[model samples]
Target: MDVVVIETRPLGDRSYLVHDGEVALVIDPQRDTDRVEAAAAEADVRITHVAETHLHNDYLTGGLILARAHGAEYLVSANDDVAFDRTPMADGGTVQVGRLTVKAVATPGHTHHHLSYVVSDGEDQAVFSGGSLLYGSVGRTDLVSDEDTEDLTRAQYSSVRRLAAEAQPDAALYPTHGFGSFCSSGPASSARSSTVAEQQESNHAFTDADEDHFVRELINNLTAYPSYYAHMAPANRQGPGPADLTVPESVDPAELSRRLADGEWVVDLRHRVAFASRHLQGSVSFEYGRGSSFTAYLGWVLPWNQKMTLVGSEEDIEKAIRDLSRIGIDSPDAALGTDPSALAPGTAVVHYPRVGWAEMLHGRSAGDVVLDVRRTDEYDAGHVAGAVNVPLHELLGRMAEVPAGTVWVHCATGYRSGVAASLLQRAGRQVVHVDAKYGPS
Candidate 1:
């Protein structure tokens, strides 16, 4: 048996393609089925089974459509209250795929009905741990509900132990979350691969035997997750269809201006520096390129189901469409170009000055406000002295609270700051983007 990883880096998750020469089983697939199809085609294996670890709270699952298209069985936990038909996989149940055997192990905690699949070829075995046993940590327990957090945290501790006890000592460990994913409770091991034995030696869940201490530590360390996660489980439960990757209708300068005038979202997908130099007056900066958390941040900042327009090069716009579709944002109108004058003729194009922490510190004015747009937890850890804290996620609703001044906005690595600066500029604040990594200067 061979296990292939399908990485979705923007969401910091992975889906797997497990095959036994002729047949394949896909676990925790994202909404885009083409990626999975391409992988299966390359491997020259027939997809005979598609399994979901749980009702995902990150991205919509492609398991349902992928299964239907290939005439494969769709496997979901029997305990979940989903709307569609599926081959209910109860704990200890087994499914055979050619020479491989898949056994469902009920490992609740990420969700109440979460299951980990242990696949074996009668000799070597691998565990698809889903959200349970991650590299150095596990999935966050607070996503379920505040009322259930304590119970789930305790359950997570037990679940990790249960999976470790049941699986072979050397079983290859694979997880769906924990590669810089918000789903993970804390930082994951950077090692490329891990096994049950290695995790047993290193993973905190295993190293800390006292369940009470483990539960408290995990809950206390839990930080804020993306605002868009609330819609994922509900959408997955309803069995969403394939993503709409069709290129949005191209809009002219007049239409783009009208959308901007109507207060519709006009996202500019340019480099942060380029966007800071010149952009459409009312356009919001959500740079779509390397090193940018384009999809996650955009999905988090934008109101759910809001009709929006994209402004960028054709390549960026195309990729942005695909990225947005993964988070259930589809069919957005687009305007192709970087030139603000060409894209929104005769409108007031704007620019903001960008600086590093040292430059801002050296050139400080008494009236200049240092605004930290990182999360509350990040602000608590350490931040610029006297920097006002308004997490990027909460900034939209609490704009009035930001003290009136020439705002110098910053974040850990300038991504959130770029977005915050653009929003503040659009709102008519005199803003400067501190486009540099945060550190002691």
Candidate 2:
């Protein structure tokens, strides 16, 4: 069997397409099915099956629709109560793709009903460890609820031990969520691939540590999941439709005023630098591009009750709607992708100011605030000495907490800071963005 990894960057989640020249199996696909179809076309194999590890909470799954389009069987755990039609993959259940065999191994830890599939071409073997096991760690058990976390952590430990004992010693491990994905609890081992034997020797999951200690470490180390995560489970339970890729109706600048007055969302989708130069006064600046962290941050920042209108290039607007749909921001009510010169009278085109970190430090004052917009945990780990920790997601509600006068907004990298600076400027603060890029230092 040939296994190809489809990695979505920025978030770094992965999907896999395993084929044997004649038939293929797609595992944990994203909402955009074009890439998967293109890969299948290039491989010259008909897609025969699509399988999901569990009901995804991070993003919408394209498996059911992909299966229907290709007349392939869609697989989900028998223990899962799916809203739509699917073939239940009971533990030890087997499916065939041409000459290759795919067997489901029940591993319920990532969710209440997660599965790890072991594939074989009679002699050679590979394990599609969907979230149960990873290179150096396993899936986070706390995403479900506080009450279920410890039980799930123990289940994860037992499930991984089962895989190590049963799967081929040299079987390749292909996990769905360890490449810097928030679903994972620790850093990835190596970028490419590792075998069962290798993971056994080095992976702490296989060590002789006590289960209680492992659970303590896992819970203590899990970083904050975005508030947008709350919307994913219910959205997936209802089953999201295929993403709508059409450009929305372009409302007049006059209508935009009325919407803004009515508390609608007018998201500005330009680069941070472009948005900093000039933008519509009441609009929220959320930079959009090919590989931006737009979906997560936009979902985190945009008010759920407000009607939204996306502003960007036609190409970007199309892709934006698709990406947004994955996180249940299905339809933007309207759109406008033209020069801002025609904006309604006195719309007040605003500007965001910037300064380097060195300049910000050198010219610092008691009242000039250094606002850090990263997550609280990130801020706690190590931030610029006295920077205030107001994560960009919470900035809308916590604007009062920022000290009066000139505010200096920054994040670990500059992406989130750009967003924070825009919000502050829109709120009538004299803000200066810390423009230099830095990681966790």
Candidate 3:
């Protein structure tokens, strides 16, 4: 038997391909299905089954696509209760691919229908635990209902314990997610797979911690989930309908401005601090730092047909595009410094060292209304006095709230404020962006 683990790095998602001589089975495939197909072809085996441990809230599962392309059976947990066109798997039920026997194990803490699969090669067994367990952490229970939190957490505890006790101490452990993923806490390293003996001694949730403490730590450290989750749950439940997996050509900034003027959405894909410092005035700011959930949130909050532009450093372009594609938002145009057409015929743009006492006072008296697009918390922490707070995330929704005519917007740095200025100009509002020293230019 041969087992290959495919790691979608920078994203920290893991998928597995298990094969014997004639048939193969894939577990938790990523959105890119070509690689899986190539691997199967290279090994001279037919893919017989595609399995999803749970409905994912991060990236769209490639199970349906892989199943259709290869004419394989798509298996998901029967307990999931979501409508999907696949064979429903129950605990103890088994599927076979050559010498491999795959058994479903219900592990529902991350979600009500979550399943962990136990793979046996006649003599040895390995568990594809999914989100139920990771190297240093367990799957978060808050992705689902509060009513199921306790039940799911309890179920997870037992499931991990069962795997630790029953599966061979040497059986390899493979999970769908690792560190840097919102699904699990801690670093994703080769340490992800451990022997039962190692887990018994080092896994916190498995040993030193109780259910209540486990739940408390998870909930307390939980960052704000991407707003897209609410939508992704239902979308995944129904199965991600057909989508073209091609990356679109990069777009020009001027064209992006035209789209925004026509009421299309513009997204600033920078970090929170960069976005807060300065951004396209009316553009929506969604940080990728939050996780792949950024795509999901944009899907729910922004209109599907809305044209979009990306504003960030060159390094972020590929990731920004990939994340957007995960949620079905593709083909975003790249942003340039300023949209020339959006600017007035001769509107002057100014640069500043910082929104210091002197800069703010001078800019304000010079008919520039200082705009603070940072979050409420940031604004309260001593911003240039009198600057109005309209966080970048809320900018588009609150366009009417900002006073019209000759506005000077600034964030902690100049990058986001510049993004904000471009957005305002696209909206046909007169504005000059202040590239303060403290912010990105």
Candidate 4:
């Protein structure tokens, strides 16, 4: 058996294409099904099945659409009260595709109906642990509901133990979460690969003998996830349609000006340094590039379903649209290019100063405010002395709380502070972006 890992790095998740050379099965695919199809084609395998471990809370699943397109069986947990039809899989149920035998194991943790798939040929086996039994941690159980958090966390502990007990020690452990996804409850191991034995030897689920302590620790450590996550499960339950990755109609200088004047979300996708150097007066900076979480943070901060306009080159806009679509933010309008003044004629182009930690520290004054735009938990862990905290996700709604002063904003990394700086600038506040890592100078 051969497995191909399809990584969606922007969201920090992985989907798998498992095959026995001729027939393949896709596990936990994202909304963009083209990537799965492309992987199948490249491997010279026919996709015979598409399976979802649960109704995901992170991104829309492409299982239904991919199954229909390939004439393959779509498998979902039998207990899920979804609107669409699916091959309902019960615990201990089995299916065969070519030489591979797939067994469904009931592992309710991340969600009540979650299942982990065990796929094996005659000699080799692998586990497709969608949200259960991660590399070093387990999927966050709070996504189900606030009321069910404790109960599900207990179940999560049991579920991971069960996976470790049932699967062979040598079997390859492939989890869909825990690869830098918010779905992970704790710090996940950075190891590229792990086995059941490796997990049993070091995973907290096994090392921590006290279940009560385990549950409490897991619950307490859970941090704030993206605000857009609340929409994913509902959309998945209704069976979302294909993602429209096509670029929206271009807005000329006049139309762009009108959108900006009318208070529409015109997002500028450039380097934060470039955005700070020069940008449209009202356009917000959500720089789209490597290591920048343009999709998640933008979707989180922006009002849900708000009509947004992108400002960047055609390539950047296209990439931004695709990333946004994965989180169900689709068909956003675009203004193609980086020159802020040219994009909106007669409108004021704005600029802000970006400083490092040293500059921010040395230039501190009695009236100047240091705004820490990280999450509450992140701020609680450590922060700049006397820095006022209003997380980036909550900044839009609580802008009034920010003190009157020249604000110097910073996050653990500068990506979020860059965004915060732009928002502050848009709101007519004097701002300096601390565009550097947070630590000793």
Candidate 5:
């Protein structure tokens, strides 16, 4: 038997193709199905099965697409309440493909229906432990409800313990999600496989810590999940197609400006710090960090009719667009160039100047609304007097909460403030971005 692991970068997702002679199986396919299909063709093996661990809240799965195209059996955890035409695999059930045995393990912590699979070539076993167990940590419970969350975490603990006790120490382990993945609660590792014994000794979620400690740590480490998660579940339930996964072409700054003026949303895909420092006025700073949650967040914040433009390095344009598309926000004309000076008309360029205490006081007296777009934690650690707290990440979604009309935006250095300014300006508000590239001290 041969197993191949495919890494989907940026999203930090992984899919696998396991083959035994002329038979093949695919696990947790990403949005792009062409590559998986091509690989199967090259191997001259018939795709016998396409399996999903659970209903993902991140990217749309390609399991149905691959199944329909190849006449492969579509398998999912039996506990998934969402209706789909496929063979639901129960816990401990095994499916045979030539000499390979794919055993389903019910491990429901990340979601109520989540499952992990163990594969064997009649002898040695390799577990495709989906979201249940990752490199350093386990899947998060907040992906579902509080009860489900605790239940899944507890189940995950048992699942890992069982694998440690039953599976061989040298049995290869493969997971669906990794580092930079929103589904994972801990940092991902570069090392592909670790023995059951090694995980028993080293994996934090599996060793030394009690259940209560593990649950507390898991909940605390989970960052804000994207708002788009509310939409993803239903879309996956409906079994949507993967045809609309295309990136937007780069647009001139001037054209981008016109779109913003016409009520289009300008999304600056820079880091929060980069956006606050200097950016076009009225542009919302929706920084894309690791994982599928970014797409979910965009869906929650951005409307369908809103024309969108991306402000980032040229390399980031394609990725930004792809991330947006996963949640059904297909704004092909939203991409903008990276140069700050070339920003389209109506774009508010951020400027942060270093000045003395007296100069800072004078500027505030001159009537600039001292806009503070950092998180609550950053805001409490001493900020400009009279500045209002509006985190850059939540600015786009909470537009009504921001004071209308004209304002001066600033963050610690002005990176995120720039992004905030661009987003606000595109939203049809007037803004003057303060260039705080240098500290007041």
Candidate 6:
């Protein structure tokens, strides 16, 4: 059997294309289908099947689209009551394509309906454990709900143990959430694949802890996930629309003004310093090439799948649109390369003051508030005393919670805080960005 690993580095999700001589299958594919199709073409095999372990919350899946396009069967956990058509799979369910034998194993930990697929050629096999038994740690159970966290975590322990015992120590372990994915209970061991024997020896969750200890460690370790996650499962359940890679039309000043008036987000994709110098009156700073990939970790703060206009250098529009498409954000209404002053003529523009951490500490008075825009867990780990904990993802709706006077914004590093500082300035707050060391030092 030929197993091709497709890593969507932007979102830290790994998909797999398993093929034999004449037929192939895809597992846990993200919205992007180009790579999957390419692998199949290279192997000279037709894609015969696509399987999803569960309703994905981290990003949209392309299973339905791939299945429709290829005239292949689509497989999903029978437990999920999705609206669309699919071959419902249960534990012990089996399917065959060419020489490959596929079997589904029920692993209810990440979600209530999660299933792990094992594809074997005679005695040799690999497990497509999507968000279940990960490389160094297990999947985060709390993504569904706080109440389900402990129960699912307990179930996870049993599930992993069962998988290791049944697959034997030698079977290859391939998981969907790895690399730098936030869905893992802890960090991945490496970007590479591992064997069940290797995980049994090295992984903390797999080898070291009991069920009670595992639950505590997992719950305590989970930080704030993306706000956009709440919408992903439902979107995937309904069956997502096809990939929209259309380069948006250039909007005139009047259209830009109308969209801004109608509550569309005008995101500035330049560096923070450039944005702070001068930008559209209400535009928010969201640089495309910041600390992380723009679409992967930080882009979830906005509405998923909704089209938003881009404001930045003319050269950046194409790359920005491609980045947004990875997470199912395809409707990039327009990209404006001109200066904000030129794009939104007669509209009021704004700017904010950027200060180093030391300057902020020495210069600001008690009346000036320090706003930490990192994750809640990051703030909890250690933060400057009296810093308001409003994560960048939750900032737009919680402006009232920020103090009235000067709001000094910061993140562990500077990228997130830069975005937050721009937002505060756009909201008419007196903003000071502590763009230097502000974490525990």
User: Considering every candidate listed, which one attains the maximal lDDT?
Assistant: 4
Error at 16, model 4, angstroms: 0.8
Ranked by lDDT, the better of candidates 2 and 3 is: 2
Better of 3 and 5 by TM-score: 5
Cα lDDT tens digits, model 2, 197-226, are: 888887777774788887777778877776
lDDT values for all models: 0.90, 0.81, 0.68, 0.91, 0.70, 0.82
Candidate 5 per-residue C-alpha lDDT over 1-441 given as tens digits, one digit per residue, 9 for 90 to 100? 888777776566788899986989999887668778888878888999999988887677778888898899988877676566988898888899778988887777777777788888977888787787788777777877755666676777777776566567777778887656677775456666765566666788777468887776766666655566666667777776774645556677678767655666677777655665666655666677654244544565466446667778666666766666655566456455555557775575763333333444455545456667776757776777677888877887787877654667777655556556666666666666664652545
Candidate 2: lDDT over CA atoms?
Answer: 0.81
What would you estimate as the lDDT of candidate 1? 0.90
lDDT, candidate 4, 1-441, per-residue tens: 999999988888899999999999999999999999999999999999999998999899998999989999999999999999899998888999899999999899999989999889988889999899999899999998899999999999999878767678899999998877888887689887898889899999889999999999999999999999999999999998999999877798998998888888999999999999998889899999976877889989989998889999999999888888899998999998778888888888889998888998898788999999999998998877878999999998999999999999999989999999999888889999999998734
Give me the runs in candidate 2 sitting further than 4 Å from their true place: 333-338, 342-346, 438-441
Which should have the higher lDDT, number 3 or number 4? 4
Each model's total of backbone clashes: 0, 0, 23, 0, 40, 0
228 in model 4: Cα distance from truth in Å?
A: 0.6
Candidate 6's TM-score: 0.91
Model 3 lDDT per residue over 144-252, tens place: 8767766777777777787666577877788887655667742234574675566666776677467777666656565444455665667777767544544445455
Task: Kindly report which residue stretches of model 6 are placed more than 4 angstroms away from their true locations once superposed.
Answer: 261-263, 290-293, 296-299, 303-307, 313-316, 322-330
Task: Answer with 3 or 6, whichever has the higher lDDT.
Answer: 6
Each prediction's TM-score versus the true structure: 0.98, 0.93, 0.71, 0.98, 0.77, 0.91
Q: What tens digits encode model 1's per-residue C-alpha lDDT throughout 311-346?
A: 989999988988888878878989988788898887
